[model samples]
Target: MRKKKVLLVLLLISQFIVLAQDYKFGKVSKEELKEKFYPLDSTADAAYLYKSRRTYYDYVQNMGFQLVTEIHERVKIYTKEGFDMATKAIVYYTPESGEDERVNSIKGYTFNLVGNKIQKEKLSQKSVFREQLNRFRTSKKITMPKIKEGSVIEIKYKLISPYIQSINDFHFQHHIPVKKLEAQVEIPEYFVFNKKTIGYYNVKLIKESKGGRIGDTQYGVNVFKFDEDNIPALKNDEPFVSNISNYRAGMKFELTQMNFISIGGDFKTFSSSWSNVSKQIYKSSSFGGELSKSGYYKDDLEKILTENTTETDKLLAVFQFIKGKVKWNEYYGIYSDKGVRKAYKDRVGNVADINLMLTSMLRSAGLNANPVLVSTRNNGVPVFPTIDGFNYVISMVELTNRGYVLLDATEPYSTPNILPKRTLNWNGRKITKEGNSSWVKLTSSKPAAEDNNLMVTISKDLLVTGLFRTKYFNLSGLTYRKNHNHLTEESVINSLEEKNNLEIEEFKLINENLIGKPVIRNVKFSSDNLVESINGKIYLEPMLFLTQHTNPFKLAGRKFPVDFTTPWKVKNMVSIKIPKGYKVEKLPESIAVGLPENLGVFKFKVKESGGKINTICVLQFNNAIIAPQYYNALKDFYGQIVKKQSEKIVLVKQ
Candidate 1:
């Protein structure tokens, strides 16, 4: 029976190998090139015919073991939209080892069928370009010579790195359909690694061992193989997603330990746990070491604290001073660049240098403060305690009431407890002076609020003239300033007029430069599209231009939770003055709806009093993130809002 089972396994493995052999480089099948559309996903612009990766470690005489990865991919373009697939870019990090850790040995071919003949064009060096992304990363871009619809392209490359402990994540799913995917990782028995599978899709795994001998010592190569077939595309068009890549199906490997018991070498741990990772990070000269030095901004901070007797006043004073003292260089990092003192003198620094400097100044003021390690919006949320996870840093100060306020001096519009949208990911790790750490929520406890008040006047000519005023508060105000502060007056006016379907003659924006104050925008506009007149009867949308015509959540089912970034509320009031000779014929009924679990609420009411008809709508969401289980409820909640806001009021000739 055991022999039979072994034979069955070997047969399956041999069959898989035979299938892989059909997809070798320079061997594009005619049928694959002639294919019109993918079978699994008809909407896919292109499909990955076969994707493969083989990664292992190579030991050197003196330098130690290095990481090597071999990659191959074949794709079929079904339409002009798939032209983007013709260009491939590989991003690699440059470290102390230099050129050895880069993408090398790249070869590509584009094949097209012309009258039963395959015309192939080789990828030229002129088509390849290398660009430096930052101090540590670079990209290699390769554009194929010729590509068109119904063409198949194959590319192969190798990545060599001296850092065996650092492994790039292998994606199991992509934005387009993948017909077949195979990934394998081989590690020596002396090394230990922790593997975590991310995203909603599940993958199949197989483990095997091959025995070998080195210097009379027997070792085993533990192989981890992943296989998947017919993976549909991961649609990322969902609304309010912080980062879609974070929810992608992929594999992450972290080096846990190097056990040399068999090789008679020393054992070491890389990133083991949160405490260890925090300590390892704090030991770096760029982080904890930089925080200990304060002579650069000491004099300035002392003056501010002395002038402000209260702690809140001192906190605000120090926060503003940091924002003015140093400007962000538009780089994200947890490690300081050129140190804080140098940044203070030059008035330019990265996220770490500015926020760490802020934390140090708050400490110098006798307030309890610490540096928080963060992952930006583009950087996926960190689910595990790995040193490579966080890419940003901010300052957190503790108040006497035991509440803490997070501050990021990198943003010009960020208020205390209200951070930039990019920094408001899942959570951050707060590191104390002792190098101890704990997870802290990055979102604010307060809700962002937007209030809109509109006064509408209807003319007998069926034109509507109105004054629209709106105010943004809390994080809402920060978002407005971030988006509109640098925009030109004419551009802002144009955008408002286009969005509201009106012609604006007067526009006023107040408190745009004042931090911690609500931003107010008032516009006077005339529109002919707001009212429809038929048979001496006027039909007007009570909500006017602000009607919720469409719902943002359109997916039939969602795999990931909706991320709103912050709890928010919207309050809208409309006062519509009917024409002088017209009387109210009908009005939209008042309605109120609430989401399950007290997650959200919507209250809408309309009243006709005296000469004015008024409508008030308040929508409040208490939670920023709505779980996938509540997706249907949230969808229904928005549906009700749309239905209520779309109702029209009828005004008849009296």
Candidate 2:
């Protein structure tokens, strides 16, 4: 009887331990939450209800015990002005767990407010881990029955959430006055635990005034605050293997003020995760057996070869075919079960799958094509051969006679010769057959082509006839082509006319055949009352309203590099035929200007011959990137050019 009683006590103790080990996140219904926390301001225009429950457990996987979390969230927004508020929110859960059963510990929160101050009314309820939850409740009370115009009203709120988790929520009981006030909210997305985990959130605009700009009043909630120590530290567990620990994994929320607008609402999280281990898992599975798939090639090599005569022609044909046939879905992820061949057959995929297909196809065609990994400008810079840092992929094809061509099919307007601006980072890595990668140059030595020409003629009545020609090559040319393709011809001409305040009579564009080649635009127009008549004399701009002077460099001190990839060269000529009784009374002296080291050059000349005053001006900038150390010299050079361009010529009429 004593032994049986002891066993029963042991069983009861085991049951208690099991119950204590279980952790869960639960959601309270809207009615229940409202009943629990009633609003102090009954006349408030908006109300919100939000609840989240998080549960942690231990599970056995491949190596050992790992932590698993199941978090659930729900939110409701109420407004008296109707449900027009835009609200977007999201939650992510890690699909896998690591060696530790408890992967993360809750952290703290940083809150900021605009248009009003905030105060805490009550502290948060404590948890099992003795984690102190900070709760803020508004301290001010409103007793006034009516709010007067031009009166400053204070807005306040109380915020509570896990310190290790990102919280972006706003609650207000009054309508935001749109006439004289604005508001903004910024929140950090990550919190610190022992190991780094990826997190993301969703943002939504719930209520908005009709016909108002949505984004103008709404911005991202996720604002990243830089921390020097928050960067993941490299751990040397294996030889040459480093692991980064400081990482925030989550989406952010953003809000902006609108024109004379007031907003009242709440932001809530629907889901979340503690870490991001999918990157490595995905790379290993997808690329391992990609080549064996069927229907990988669109057509046999013989058929494709018969369609093209020359190598360049074949290359262009293949490029165009791929661009037209494959659709860009704009999804970016390191892992997907769909193989490259399957994606190619389906006619859609992310950057990695599509660019990898391009590389493979080129290799199959007996060409030297390699997949290059790069971190886009928006994605930050790359961290060398870390492998996990790259988020975008592009292809580089080598030509026997020519050099190399970089291609990104995702960029629709990008031509064969033009590389996208996002890829102009420090460098990229070329993935080779043996799994070895080499550094590749992302900058181009070739400069962008530029040309500017203007011709002006003036009559005795001050009527002006002007002809303008612009030619662009390389980067300059690519930019124009991309922009021009998006707009109609009439819109382009109208824009030019409006900018110059002239009545355009004719406009024409040429050089459409050469992809990524120089683009040329020719425009002719006439305008009356262009010259000012003062004190019985007419003063006319020598270049007939053309911008003859420009400030290319603006930095005070030059310690940074100067960019000259997009160089500039302009030429202007103005011929004013003397009216029957008019002759040149005053002509500005000719001047030549340039940087001391020949960094740039500018020149202006005036001459009177055959009853005509001819004014000529020229300016050229040869560098693409300039250093801060040379900024003063460059600035002075441009200043002189501007003065010369603005010089006026005096004309006397008899």
Among the numbered candidates, top TM-score falls to 1
Worst 10 residues of 1 by lDDT: 12-21
Q: Number of clashing residue pairs in every model?
A: 0, 73
Q: How well is each residue in 91-123 modelled by candidate 2, as lDDT tens digits?
A: 222233221112233321111122353211221
lDDT of model 2, residue 345:
73
Cα error of candidate 1 at position 464, Å: 0.7
Please give the CA lDDT of all the candidate structures.
Answer: 0.89, 0.49
Among all candidates shown, the one with the greatest lDDT: 1
Per-residue lDDT of model 1, residues 1-654, tens digit only: 999999987885455334434887889877777778875567899998899999998777677778999999999999999999999889888743355477889999999998898889898889989987656678899998789999999899999998777888888888898888989999899888889999888888899988755656678899999988877788787788888888888899888889886676888888778888888888888899999999988779878977987779889999999999899999899988778999999999999999999999999998999999998889997667788899999999989986899999999999999999989888999989887899999989989999999998998898899899999999999999989999999999999888888999899999999998999999999999999988889998889998989999898889899988899999999999978999999999999899989999999999999899999999999999999999999998999999999998999988
After superposing candidate 1, which stretches have Cα over 4 Å from the reference? 1-21, 96-100
> How far is each candidate from the true structure, as Cα RMSD in Å?
5.1, 20.0
TM-scores, all models, native as reference = 0.94, 0.56
In angstroms, give how far residue 243 of model 2 lies from its true place. Answer: 27
